[model samples]
Structure formats: C-alpha cells, structure tokens
Target: MKRAKLVIGLLGIMLFLAACGNLNSSSMSSSGTNGSKGTQLTGQSTDSNYEGVIENGKYVTSKSRGVSNTQDAGNQLNLKSFEKGLLNVSQQEFSTNKYAFREGQILTKKVVSNWLARESKSNADGLNPKDNGSTSATKRNPIYLQQLEEQDYMIQKNNKLSLGGITIGLGINSVDYYKKTQYGATYETKISKAEAEKQGKAIANKVLMRLRQYDSLKNVPIVIALYRQASDDSLVGGNFFAYSVNKNGTTKVKSWEKLNQKSYVFPIADSQTSPNTNDTTSFDNFKNEVEDFFPNLSGVTAQAQYTNNQLDGMNVNITTQFYSQTEIISFTQFLQTAAQKYLPAKVPIDIQVSSTEGVQSFLSRSENGKKFTTHVFNSY
Candidate 1:
C-alpha cells in the first residue's frame, strides 16, 4: 500500500512538470520573469490588451488563475502591414479632415494622400472670389465687426458685393455652417485649461524644446507651455499676466507680452541655466512651418532658402498649434511602440490623455492660427 501511494504521488508531480514543460517556449520566453531582456514589453505596453497573453508561446494565464492554451498570435489590429501605399480614411474624424483641411487638427497619412489626390480642385462650389457674390474686402479681416457682419451676411445670402462697389448675387445660402461649429474639419483646434494639464505635454515641450540639452532627466519636470495669441503692440502696451508651473506643482508668476507668430523671437536658455528640460528641439529645426514643411527640407537647406527668401507661403504659418495636435498624436504612437518593444508579454499600461484641445462644443475655422474664410458666388 505504501509503495503504491509513493508511486501515485510521484506520477502527480511528473504530470505537473510535464504540463509546465508543454507551455509555448516563445510565449514563455517573452512572458513573466521568464522573458529575455530585449524581448520583454516596455512600460508603454502596459495598456496592451494582449499583454502577457501567453507564456512559452502556447499557454495563457486566465483571469481566474487557471492556465489556458493559446496561439502565439501577434496583434490582431496590426492590419497596416499588407496594406501599403495610400489608404482611405475609414473613420469620420479622419476622412473629413482628409478631403477638407482644418486648422489645429494633425494631418494623418491618409489625409495627406487624399489632399494630393484631390479629385476636385475646382472652386465650382459656387463661391469664388471672382464670382459676383464674394466678400468684397481686400483686407482678410476687416477692422469693423459690421464689415465682417456685412461680409458674413453676403457670404450666407450668396450675394457678391463689388470688389470696389458693385453688388452681385448668387442667391446662394449665406450662413456659414462652419462659423457655428469651428471645431470640425474646418475649425481651429483649441484645448481647455483642464485638458491642457493632461495632454498639453508635447506642446509644452515644443515651447521649451531645444536643440541642446537643458537639464538632467532625474531632476526634469514635465512642463505645460501655453502660448496665447496677442494683439500687435499699438501706441501702448497692454496689461496681462502670465504664469509658469514646474513638475512639482509650484508656479512661477510672469508678466510679459503675448508673442505673435512670424514676428517674435522666442527666448532660449542653457540647460544648466534653466530647470529640467524634455530635450525637445525648439522650432529652430522647423524654420519652415508644418503646413509648409515639405518632403525635401533639411537643416542646412532650409537655412539657405531662408537667406535667399525662397521658402513657400505655407512654411511661414507654422506656429504653436502646428506642433500641439501633431505632437500629441505622434507621442501616443511612440508610447505604444515603446511598450510593445520593451516590456513583458502581459504587463499592462494605461494612458490617460487630457488637453485643452479635448473634445468641445465649438471649433474655430483657422489656418495656421488665423481665422479665415473664402466665399465665392457667381451669378450669371
């Protein structure tokens, strides 16, 4: 009886060992404590749903603490591999921005493709500047609100006012739908104070982004830089207050002028002189703006062009906004890539994104940080 009992106990132990041995080797290799160095997922993958999906490549640890068998299947959504070249924006937020360009929204690959491959470049939408029913003012933004209102009314009614003094009517719809909701594919993207605290990082970094080092990482604190639009200096300076907050939650007070685009020199400081820095290069690298940055620009060439005054108009409008939305989108992607490349198979990472540009009720119709609209109406 004793010998039989011993044999049974040994058999049970053997079965457990065999089960452990049967686990998928690759899965286990990239799993828990068993994963190798570079093979493990990084902190970025903490949010991955498939994190730690398997051990030894064939077994998964169930939420109930039981072991289940699974394949070494890779990402289910990594569908971009086979589909190369240009792709269609299948989603609304993506597609709308594609066919029609908007301010503040980051341009995606699909949007760029659609823009270049635009099927219709014709201004036949019945709203052309040359048309009888177009805004008459040569000045983009007229000084008087009444003039703007007048132009706005004309645009809605589809009536063209003479460039000099004549009235032409397309009898077209006048009210601009985009005027009401500027945050859509036609509006300037703005974030909220609360949201900025959350996702305004890369932007903040861009404000302080420099080509050289600013400080050591251990002491570096995340920054939230806000660049508000300011009026041009008139006969007298305006009164306004500014504030700077470090990573420790302490805020430094400041009194300064609101810097306008293409006219102001952004202040720069040495890493040792300044506090902790994120190592993001200032717009110096982007002498040309985002809407303007083309496929062929490098540091030396752009500088040469600037000296020669040959840079394009689009390059001139790059501003805080150009980097804000774009950097956020790229940052999220970088985090995901980093996580997948560094951490274990099962480690979890959750991202909480917030920004002044967070979802909102209204949007601005701005181009390169300026509000602009073109209404063309032709009456035969």
Candidate 2:
C-alpha cells in the first residue's frame, strides 16, 4: 500500500479497471457509463437498464458496475476501530472502543447478554457444534472481558484477488410445463441456493487475502459476509452468509484462507457436468453434491464468529460492526466512488467482486419454481 492520496488513488483504480479492455464475458464486456476502472460507477439515471431508488419511479442512474453510485456503497456496519482504512460515520458508534477489534484478534468482551457469549462459542463449533438428537447443540460460554490482547504474524501475500465461480445447483424433481407433466427437471440458473453461500465466503476470503498481502496494511479486516438476496431479505432461503469453516473451526473467511492462499477463483457449480434444477425438484441430489464437497461454510452462525474473533485483527483496528445484507442496490456507483474517494491511498490494491448474477436480480426473477445457477465472484 503505497501513499498516493487515498481519494485520487482510488479514483485511479476505478478508471484503470474500466479501461483495462473487454470484461472477458457478456456481463463484464458490456459497456457502462460511470467508468471507474472495474467499478463502472455511475451517476443519476434516465436509463432503462439502471434501477436505483427511482427519481420519478424510474432508475436514478446508469447500471454501471457494483451498483450505481447513489445508494449506500457496501454493507456498512457500526465502526469501532481502524488499523487499515478510515472508519465510516456509522462504524464509529457501533461499539465501546475503536481499539476493540481487528482481523484474527480475539476478545472476551463483557457480556452484552447471557446468550451473547453462548452464541459466539456455538458459532466457534463450526460443523461439530451440535448433537444429532437435537435441532441445535450446546455452545461454549465465552469469557466476558473488559480488555483483550493482540498477537501478530507475517506471511507472504498478494494484493490481487481473481475470482471465477459456477452457480450452485440443488437438483430436484419438478413439473415440466413444456412437457405438460411432472418430470425430473434440472434448472439452470445464474446462482444456485448453495452456490451463493459458497461463492460469498470464498470471495470474502479472496479479498481478505489480497488485503493481507501488504505489510503496511497490517490492520485487521472486518469480514462482512452477505448475500445478493433481492431487496426482499425474507424471500431468500438463507438471509446472509456468516462464516467459512476453516481448520481451527467456525471462523470468518479471512481466518479460513489465511496463510493458505493469496487468491482463489473458483465456481459455485458442484461440477461442470452437472445440470440445473426446476420447479418440482426436491433438491436432494444437488444439495448433497454441494454439501458433500463444499468448503467450510457459515450457515447461520457466521456473523457471531466474525464479530467476536476474526473481525478484529492483530495490528489493524477494525472495530466496526456491520450486519449482512442481500444486495448493493443504488449506491453501487457511489460505493465505487467512495472506494475511489477513501481507500487506503498509501496501501492501495484493487479488489473486484462479481456474483454470477447481481444478488438482487437473482431472487426477484427466479422465484416460483424457477431455478438459477452459475455465479462468478471475483476480486481484483
């Protein structure tokens, strides 16, 4: 992370990504307005392709990259600390102290509630957290501490994170409208139910690893796991993805891929040869395939692990606590600008995140028995 003036450097990255050439795919290759490197950030809209908060009921800006720059940028949380970038307004008020967190930094904070520590420990269990007889298992009681210690380590790193993903498929038996009968229909969608989670955690890890590449950026990161669930959060089968299973146990994605790989570009689809799903499907085969050979994923307890353990790193202070969301609606462009406007200028690196399809649109159009598959999540 070299010093280039945070604002200008971020702008340079956006511009750079935009002009780098064809995006290499239908979605990437398409031309967009607000060109900011890969961000493709845009402004107020009159275009049909765009859809932020409508001015008169129509999109306010062009459908550039991320989301148009009007709405909130990324899923922002309450800031509590900073070791890397500047904390936004919302983050500063989330916790008791700014120095309370960072990537890999752990704490036994004073109990916010009796169930609070219990939940964090339950999340720490990862796959083995529960017993077969119960719907859930008992969780460890986390220590309630007023203070914490920090530990640091060094490792080889890369700033660039490249991502490629396939849609998640949940094979099921469904009705065949075309055949006018019940049939074994495999649906082909942009992102699968299971794949959305897989790719989300993977993408988070990829970006975190890229951030870890720099010695100057020793600040811990707040792993914000989310989904592109259409605006209606309830419609999603799973609200937000929380954590990735790693060697130690349930932890933030940053902890999962830490020291293991610099970047990961993978797919959501279990196999290139697998087929999609349809209306009548039971999701037995597809779910099994994804579950049997999937990465350690954060089902529901991901947020707790991230909030308590990995969100706070050793040297960097990422005390901010933002919850997850389904999509980056209007502010896609604004966020890119913000990214351009306020990235770590001294320690700048490009991060690209691509879902096979935008999270919002995937659910809006694919409900009512329709299936979606193949999602690509990338960070550059």
lDDT for each residue of candidate 2 in 1-380, tens digit (9 for 90 to 100): 11111121212121212221111222321223323244211221211111111122222231221111112321122112211112121122222111111122121122111211112344531211122332111222111111111112112123211211101111110110111126644221234445444544544443344334444333433333232322111111112223222222212353421211011111122542212132002123322332343233122100110122221111111111122222332223333333333222222122222233333211111111122121222235
Assess the local accuracy of residue 110 in candidate 2 as a C-alpha lDDT between 0 and 100: 27
Model 1 residue 139 CA deviation in Å: 23
lDDT of 1 by residue, 1-380 (tens): 01111111211121111111122133223233444332221111211111222223333322222110101221211112111101111111112111111111122333322322213345221111222222323322111100000000000011211111100001111111112235534322232333322222322232223201323212332222222212222111111112232332222312222212221221222432311121113233223232243232222111000112221111111112213444545433443343233212221122223334342111112212221111212125
TM-score of 1: 0.15
Q: After superposing candidate 2, which stretches have Cα over 4 Å from the reference? A: 1-190, 214-216, 231-238, 244-380
- Model 1 misplaced stretches (Cα beyond 4 Å): 1-222, 228-247, 251-380
- Candidate 1 weakest lDDT stretch, 10 residues: 145-154
- Judging by TM-score against the true structure, name the best candidate: 2
**Against the true structure, what is each candidate's TM-score?**
0.15, 0.20
